[model samples]
Target: MRIVIFGGTGFVGLNLAEVLLARGHEVTLYDRAALPLSAQRSLADYGARLKAVQGDITDVDTIDALVAEGCDAIVLGAAVTAGEDLERVSPARVLEINVMAQIPILQAAIRHGVRRVVNLSSASAYGAAGQRHQILDEETPCDPVSFYAISKFTSERSAARHAELFGGDFLSVRLSAVFGPWERPGSVRDTPSLQFQILAAFARGEPALLPAPGIKDWTYAPDAAEAVAVLIEAERPRHRLYNISSGAAWSALQWGEAFAALHPGLECRLAEPDEKTFIKLHGGDRAPLSVTRMADEFGWRARFGCAESAAAMSAWWMQHKEWI
Candidate 1:
């Protein structure tokens, strides 16, 4: 299969590209940012099976031309992960990139007869509703609050509506808090994951301070990528929406503590009362996303937990510490 991932140079996109390329599929990454040198070196083994293209996602001509050439599947991973600061300063930019730009891409997919279109959405789409519910399922009604959350929810509905009206095979997956290899600070992404922050502190030879436990069903990037790949390869999925999650709750502090134990110089602990800390948690903890839909439909479940992910990510950082 030939797959095109928008925002492919970003964190999750690179992970997904590696997954697809390893499965003997050709991957084309379309993004404005250049691929990081670490990623370029790591992906070098794939040879010509991987291609990276630099272009503005809003440019319909470029996107459509690429899609028309021959695309078996499309993954809509481009987004502006805005926080309150960005939302206050550039709200329109958030909606434009996260919502409006997606329309042309979806239309191109439909026009070119692309087999499957998967939209990457965030668990933030659940918003305040997440606080009310114990388990967020695909059918849960969303009450999105932040600009980023609103855009993701809107994109999900727009993609599903386009499929419904045009008879296209479009689907959306609501991903839980994702953090693993390849996550880094960028222009579009204002908030780095807690795990990334902890790792960065470790790299700086400083202790990591936590604002809170930062508990949530944090999904590993590779696991989340594999779930998206499953959807792209499915012959005919039963539903239009699925929740990709770890299916359990854990704290970033726990993972950090586990990681700190691996290295004698590392220290990860909660901040003292009223003490200033560099680590920033996204928001107050909310309900974990339910993976029942993914499990029932495809027998899928995230393989990594707090301790396992800590070990795996520590090994990865040892090889590519420069990436942090």
Candidate 2:
């Protein structure tokens, strides 16, 4: 299959591109800038199966040509990374990149007759976890807490609606804390409550900070990439919103202890956040759509556990000197 990925040069996009290429599909990566050195290095491993193109999502000509270049599916991974200050990328720009850009692109795809589309939505859309006990399934009403989440949720709805109106299939994957190799710099200092926290602390030379004894599911990048692939390959009705997460919950202290044990030199601290600083969890009680949904239906499984994923990421960062 030939696939075109918007924002294929970033973290998630980069990982997904590799996954698609490994499956022997022709991939065209359209990003705003040249592929980063890390991504270039990884793509080198794929040789010629992948084509990396630098292009703007706002450019109609660019969008048309790329869509016309022909692709069986399109994955929209292009957006501001979560945790970014919404004010940093003004609402106009956020709406432009997250929502407006998709209009032209989706129009192009519909005109070009692309079969399927996968929009990468964020778990942030559900706001802080643990705010509610019921799991946020596809049907849960969203109360966006930040500008980033608003843009993501809005963009997803727009694209999915467009696909429905135009006679095509669309699926949205709401991703949890995704971490792995080729992770962009920054945030290595203070990781999230989930997987990246330990890795971040190690990278920043700070003691690891674990969350209060609260539960949150952090999905590894490979699992997420596989989930997207599974959605692309799955038949229609089965294609609605799927929560792509590890489906396993762990507390902050547990994660911190595990991480501290892995690296002897690293200091592990049990520090609580100040009153002003609090972490939010998307607490949904419902078991995420069972993996059976992905396996029996789409043939997908998470190959790495949290500890295993953390170790693998740490090793990669150490190898690249990214964790210095």
**lDDT by residue for model 1 (100-163), tens:** 9999999999999999999999999999999999999988999999999999999999999999
Write the residue-wise lDDT of candidate 2 on 1-324 in tens digits: 889899887778888988888888888889886787766775787777788899887888978988997899999887765344443545567667877888888888899999888888877677653266456555667777666778878877887788679976777778876766556533211223344555566667767654444455667787789889867766674656777777776554565566667778876555565532233332332233334455566656787775777667656665676423
Q: Which ten residues in a row have the lowest lDDT in candidate 1?
A: 277-286
Off by over 4 Å in 2: 82-84, 128-130, 185-197, 210-214, 235-237, 272-296
RMSD of each: 0.7, 3.9
Please state the error at residue 301 of candidate 2 in Å. 3.5
Best by lDDT: 1
Superposition error at 262 for model 2 (Å): 3.0
TM-score of 1: 0.99
Where does model 1 exceed 4 Å of error?
none
TM-score of each: 0.99, 0.84
